[model samples]
Target: MNTPSQLLPPPPRPLLLLILDGFGERKERENNAVHLAHTPNLDSLFARYPSTLLGASGPDVGLPTGQIGNSEVGHLTIGAGRVMHTDICRIDQAITNGSFANSPVLQNLLHQAHNVHRELHIFGLVSDGKVHSALEHLFFLIERAASQAVAVVVHAFLDGRDVPPKSALKYIQALENKLEGKGRIGSISGRYYAMDRDHRWQRIHQAYQAIVHGQGMRFPTAIQGIKASYDTGKTDEFVEPFVVGTYQGVQAEGIGFHFNFRPDRARQLTEALAIQPFNRFPRTPLEHPPFPHYACMTTYDASFGLPIVFPKENPTDIFPEVIARHGLQQLRCAETEKYAHVTYFFNGGREKHFEREERILIPSPTGISTYDQQPAMSAPLIADAVIHAIESDRYDFILANFANPDMVGHTGILQAAIAAVESVDQAIGSIVNAAQAKNGAVIITSDHGNCELMLDAETGQPHTAHTLNPVPFLYIPIPTSHPLPPFRTGGKLCDIAPTLLTILGIEQPPIMTGLSLFVSS
Candidate 1:
């Protein structure tokens, strides 16, 4: 084998570096980045070259699908050049395999538990949706905490938006099983406690029964998931109507809190927003050919089974037969490259309705163009933030988060999200322009992916609203005079800072889990 000195490449040309938020995603002709509107600069970039599906295969897809990439790991690899999983998984594996005993953050937490007789609170999502936080890893953390003689108080952020409704029971059972009996391999000798919005859901279900009972639905039978419509048993076909409103409802107001739709009809809106990846649902027996009405939806502990709204928008005046004739043409007849999605939900009859064909409604138009928004900050805010960073001569690296595509997409409001993406595209131009001025290289990429999806191939409708796509890894080169490290490509997020140090001729401590993208040892 060749020695370390002979293996690495020479340093790169001197240059500045830029990282565009969510810039690593791709553009597509159908239902993709092109959906946004007025992205002149981004359009040119796409026209000149082809974009690839980034991090398509690997451990990043749920179990590192070896198919998709996520943000944390992607950035780690891009910055460091060589790494696996992310901080979450890395910490978890250390604990699982017994190496985390030495990690300072973990070690401190563990030892502190022994000294303080109080309980430790573990607050996070409680689902395998793994989009943000992972449940399996959380369990390991809980196990480790208990092993150190610490009483645990877990406040689980139930992920009804991701997993199925009322599925908290599954995770609860799992945790309960893990914490069963002390003195096990886990190391601690104390019992752990778990509780989530106690006595809340029961009252809501009761309220629904009471409200629907008056309408002659016969107790609005309780059930979850798809059961043929003919099946009398009630199914939890859910959607979350309000974001802060719903989350607030569960916290301030107890269960059985009722909201009225009709003057005398106090019906239960299953204000349960399904986690995306399944936003465009079963081909409904509706009127119009389906169009993406909303892209994002959220569900909370109290909002479960509350019939909020599916599409969460008003119905169209046109009929389905008319819409069907123009639906496919509408999908393909786009002239402009930039498109945007906007879905709005109102407090009325239903969040959405299946039109004549298959389209769903997100919300009324009022929500999209509220005069309250800042034209100055519309899309330029992203760029301004980056430029401000450079002007201030702050840190060499800036990791900022722009939430248009990811946040809005979850609402299933394809149109609105498209608009947000257009804004982001404009922002990308600003940052890239700044970096180019400084002889910088912009390595744009994403953590995980969204907005680049279709219905699961077999289902033929819409896939679950999820960031399952493989994002892009783009490198915008810049000419420079300062000494630079050799460029290392196809790395993870953990590698970025280390790589930056390497590129700038700075030294990185071995404690860091990242490697230099420019030079590798």
Candidate 2:
């Protein structure tokens, strides 16, 4: 039942794409934060508005079978309105087929290193988290570099968010085992320093000092440093940066290479390493004598790459860029961590700045690593921004992401997650009110599941990882207008873009590849 474009009249209102991060719908109420919380606004929306379940994990989000949904793939699918074969699939395939060693990207970087007579610096998260680069893939790259007679310096960032908290030692030891006598393994730090989305140059500076100057709290060994931090109640992701070997003032001087396919994270570290004559760090007057030549596994941001200069023209165009080309004005609003998810990932891994599109980034609360302390987070601020935009009627569409449930849920704190969901519910109510007042429609969905499935089924302990749960897709109709149409079926998140575009009287681009949820007359 595809709705024909001719039968559709001019939309009576604008549309809002409200993404409640990790707010999935689950029936298991025991320890389920969303179920326990007083989400009156969300409940009201569900009862009144037309809604359906969205398949958010594994194949639904376009990952390999059994792969849990993460922010990178979730947002990419949402904005693309299509199933893009994500980096997770490609990397997994590469590892399985033994093609990673012979990859063109790896070969090109190796060739560049050989031609330039410089050591190849390989940097990335050494974890089994499928969302980011995998430890197996990193090992293969290192082993291949050695075979190719290339001098390689491996900079491994710690991971605790995706994996079990404070499990950095396991990954570090594994890498050490692989790199024993093969290559130099040095400059170990937390993912927080390397994967900063906001302008947290201070964190990046700490990482740089550890990598280039070998300056940090002196640790006799890698294991000791990790254990010391763990003993002090610091998770691996926030542990102070430390060098692997003895701090002998050895800098990794060579062409740098890092494998981060996801566009949303880790740009700050790459920029700090790549940029030459760097003096941005406040505490230390630092300058890289040689501008680090580097290449990512895939160009994360096609619109803008390293050296930190805004490009006059984007190197490539993504979904938002294409939408802008069609004369659609879009407003993207999110907090620091997910700012890239909206701007960079939503735009198809390109950092394009369109005159018509505006981005609003509310800083995630600083000085606190865990989100449970500030359970409400910046939901109200983001909601206010969206409300103001809807009131102004300046943009054709507004996309907002409330990161409370996801952030707080990851902490495995039941009470905080409950409060986080409630906070999001309150914000949703405000956005809906503002939209309805201005004759606008609201479409709310989530990236993936988290707080809804809080406890592990067997263990009954708090589950910290994203779950393979379906999220709610609630559509509140334009104020005072007869319903446009009911969705044909419960669809994937990728279907969201076409649905929104159709509602806004915009043509669905062929590249979108998603079937419209509505049926034709």
Quote the positional error of residue 62 for candidate 2 in Å.
Answer: 2.7
Q: lDDT by residue for model 1 over 319-418, one digit each (tens)?
A: 1112223231111000010111111111011223223212122111122322113211234544565555545443333334454454344433445555
Question: How much is 107 displaced in model 2, in angstroms?
Answer: 3.6
Positional deviation of residue 186's Cα in model 2 after best superposition, in angstroms = 1.5
- Taking all chains together, each candidate's TM-score versus the true structure is 0.45, 0.88
Per-residue lDDT over 385-406 for candidate 2, one digit per residue giving the tens place of the 0 to 100 score: 8898888888877889999999
- Which segments of candidate 1 are over 4 A away from where they belong? 1-28, 34-38, 45-126, 132-379, 391-398, 438-441, 454-468, 479-491, 494-499, 507-521
Candidate number achieving the greatest lDDT relative to the actual structure = 2
lDDT of 2 at 382: 94
Global lDDT scores for all candidate models: 0.37, 0.75
Residue 127 C-alpha lDDT in model 1: 58
